[model samples]
Target: MISKWNILTRRKMRGVYIIAVFTTILLGLASRKFSHLLIPFIANNAGDFIWAMMVYFGFRFLFVHKGLLFAILLSFLFSFGIEFSQFYQADWMNQIRETLLGALILGKGFLTVDLIRYTAGILIAAVFDKRYSS
Candidate 1:
């Protein structure tokens, strides 16, 4: 069943997943290095959301269906993963996350609240999956 998705997406999905993996890694690094300079306002968080959507669509539209669960899970994990990174960070990232934008994306210490946001992102991707499969 899912292999059908693999066949349809094989040409495109690999390119996108590779891109997403690279982008996510780069952004994760940036969050560690320049968190203070980048975070600013609520829009900062929205920007993160946009990135998530980018990843989600990259999967739904281009990637294989069998991989979707892991893709979405990785995206969500990326969110919290970056957050935990602050503990190891020097200070700049944490400072930036303190600002409205920083907090929106980088966030503070772990909170249960993050699960809600992750779920919302996943659901949005799932909706895209169900609606666009035709």
Candidate 2:
């Protein structure tokens, strides 16, 4: 029973989410590639923060009809799950972690501080989404 306007709006929102995800990914990679140019704190935390933001945008893209809170909760769960998964050290998993693509997706190590970074990132992205997505 979707109307034409509703479908168009959903497509537009999905497009915005896709752009957000892509931009966050670029920023995350640039943060790592040019860490020396950034302040020490940003250099240390930007990748994790941006990674979390990208996760939020990705979830938003997939669940375009979901509420903001749903996206926020799901993103936090997914980000935290990935962070915690780093605790497992099986040889097969370690091999995947060693690859460039795998290393980026599955971080090499777990840091408690990364949880804070993720929280901050998700909160910030939610705030922005709430304020602007209306």
Candidate 3:
């Protein structure tokens, strides 16, 4: 049987994976370096969107040919998991969130509104991925 791994390893997908990684890095850097120049609204909201985009790319990397719906579902779940993880505030976990990389990945706190932003991000990514992959 044709497997999901086969779909992910196709030659064409390599470029998409590379692009996703590049875009994720660029967004991370922008969120860190350029955030100060953005207006407060955009600055505050951008991280949630970018995090979702990164999760979408991760889903794409894993499932490749599984298509947009799967990617959206997986990305939303992963994003929600990370956001929800913030509620567990132990010393080790708090220390992890204090570090720069950990802060980027785990986040320091949960925002109820982040769920909306994550859904928006995943949907926007699905539209973009469908348009491109078709």
Provide the clash count, candidate 2: 0
Full-model lDDT for every candidate: 0.58, 0.95, 0.82
Error of 2 at 35 (Å): 0.7
lDDT of 3: 0.82
Decoy 1 TM-score against native: 0.45
Per-residue alpha-carbon lDDT of candidate 3 for residues 1-89, written as tens digits (9 for 90 to 100): 87877755654775796588569768867986899999988788888887788788778877776767888888888999999999999
**Candidate 1 residue runs with Cα over 4 Å from true position:** 1-9, 12-45, 58-65, 91-115
**Per-candidate TM-score against the hidden true structure:** 0.45, 0.97, 0.87
Could you list the CA RMSD of all candidates, in the order they appear?
A: 7.9, 0.7, 2.8
Is 2 or 3 the stronger prediction by lDDT? 2
lDDT of 1 by residue, 19-97 (tens): 6546654664565457578656432343344446555655544446455576677667776576456565557777787
The stretch of ten residues in a row with the least summed lDDT in candidate 2 is 102-111
Better of 1 and 3 by lDDT: 3
Candidate 3 has its poorest 10 consecutive residues by lDDT at 6-15
- Write one digit per residue (lDDT tens) for candidate 2, span 26-124: 999999999999999999999999999999999999999999999999998998988999999999999999999989988988989999999999999
Clash list (residue pairs), candidate 3 = none
Top candidate, metric lDDT: 2
Q: Who is ahead in TM-score, 1 or 2?
A: 2
